[model samples]
Target: MTGTRTQVVVVGGGQAGLAAGYHLRRLGVDFVILDAQSTPGGAWQHGWDTLHLFSPAPYSSLPGRPMPHQPGQVYPDAAHVVAYLSDYEKRYELPVQRPVLVQGIHRDGPLLQVRTDSGTWSAHAVISATGTWWRPFVPAVPGRRLFEGRHLHTVTYRAPADFAGQRVIVVGGGNSGAQIAADLTGHADVTWATARPPRFLADDIDGRALFDTATARRRALDNGQADTAGVAALGDIVAVPPVRAARDAGLLNAVPMFTRLTAPGPQWPDGSITRTDAVIWCTGFRPALAHLAPLHLRDRHGRIATTGTRALDEPRLHLLGYGDWTGPASATLIGVGRPAREAAREIKAILGPGHRPQG
Candidate 1:
């Protein structure tokens, strides 16, 4: 019912949205950020208690401010990251409105109309930074609905203590699965399952190295050189401290994915069954873009075609922090900065001289 106007509206006040806000403010763009969460930490607030960054604090920061180092921590944990984000927003006094659930984004003449639970915002450009946490992806494994045991996803997983003494199967070969399985090593009877063998990056490699690798690949492509190997070429898992220790202890071995989910547990391809009390799915997530469905911009491949961060079909809309499709490593804290900067610059160009913030 209520209505507001701004030059730009950034949806989702998470890391990506914050990065965009930093650049837009620097460029004197009159904008506002709407966050679905009530607080400043974004999705980091929901990460499991023991979750930690693969890179050190300085290597994982936004555009204008570096995350403060947590004493006695090489790789900061989830709580530390949340505290840093809370501080970063206040340090810059970024204009952020919280607890506003965006319903949809629609076109209105020359402006984009963002309808939310609290109110509506009309802006020349809109950046959808609503990352994937809200939409956890679980593959439709046959018989999943028939399973009698508890089924959980990475988003809902809190701590290993919750599943103490229970037999659990962790599905997925990615970092989350490895990390969760490691956490549950002593707490639960757990089995790690992946479609293929788990790939671990060199023990010495961390997120900082992976970020650098992605940056190099981007540069090589920009210069018209042959594509270089990226983080994926190195491995899937980052081998964070816990995971490394678990692997070294021989407690983190992964088995092949189950062919089907039985009432009690999972059935292997050979028809052998593993009776389990619960199954935790760390399969991964898709972008949280349901609000953009009204725009119908996604291609047949279920992706929004984009030139850098700007959507190809809808030039006034920009997608940030989705992943490499928006910009190299755009989903990571340090990586999201480049694309956010580029998106802000592009919005400024599109809005032209008249839309600059008033002195």
Candidate 2:
């Protein structure tokens, strides 16, 4: 209930935080993972029931363990991922404390102070792995408030049953949009709105391929070289069964986003109106960096400029698993392990070998 001191304190106990814990444990540092969620599995636990990873078992796993699945099983669903993350937590015995809502973080002389709703923690360094899931971002469009239909972001979306018998518009061109649209097409009259054409990898493509491709592109871009590899981005839709089925059934069509929302529905650029019942926004999220605002590392938006997951200006803080800006493919279950390892080593180098907890 009072301030708990440690050498290192990791905020956000999702995949990125868990991955960082894996490395910090190996580094033999005294640390604790402060999780906002009461349960394990991080943000993955909140995805829709039918949501799935684009990669096979091995590719979707963390650094220490391969995701378990029956022989020949490729993509895993939300439940399996959650179970694996829960089991991974128990298997490693990571020092995790749940339901610890971090309210603010600021530098206190040589140490960083973490103030939480329940208590406080002082650490030599802090790692902010708070992924973007909690901060769903829906872009501002004219007349958005005029729509009388139901509006929901993917964060609250759980299943397709709630949307039955309605004309729905699934907005955004990424995997969530694709999957959610696919799930609803069978039950509702669905229209898809995307800023750009949704690109799909070949049926055989998976997360591993996407990560490799993204890494290649990043490396090339950093070196000022052209991207020779014709690889798609990680955000590009993977043709999962439901999405593929939707594609085959001619229901995966996407139109450019409408100019604005109307009383009845969407108003297109040509002034055409489409009557709609509900809108499910899969537009994505911004980083959850409100707690770090006291640090003065973020910009006008809640975005912190980072040097390979480390704050570009702050020496004692590192961010992980929000997106590529943190590290290559850092947002994925597979991609987070590398950044976690590197960030832990960076902290170890800065804070010395073993740290004794101080109150």
Cα RMSDs, all models: 1.6, 1.8
Q: Which regions of candidate 1 fall more than 4 Å away from where they truly are?
A: 356-359
Clashing pairs in 1: none
TM-score of each: 0.97, 0.95
lDDT of each: 0.93, 0.88
- Runs in model 2 deviating more than 4 A are 70-73, 222-224, 227-235
Q: For this target, which candidate reaches the highest TM-score against the unseen true structure?
A: 1
**Worst 10 contiguous positions by lDDT, candidate 2:** 227-236
- Residue range with the least summed lDDT across 10 consecutive positions in model 1: 350-359
Candidate 2 per-residue lDDT over residues 1-359, each given as its tens digit: 67778989999998999999999999888899999999998988888878888888888889898989835456888888889999998999999998999999988999899999899899988999999999999999889999999899999888888888999999999889999999998789999999999988788777888888878877888899986653553347889888999998898999999999999999987999999999899999988888998999867765788888789878889999988888888999999999999999999998775557766
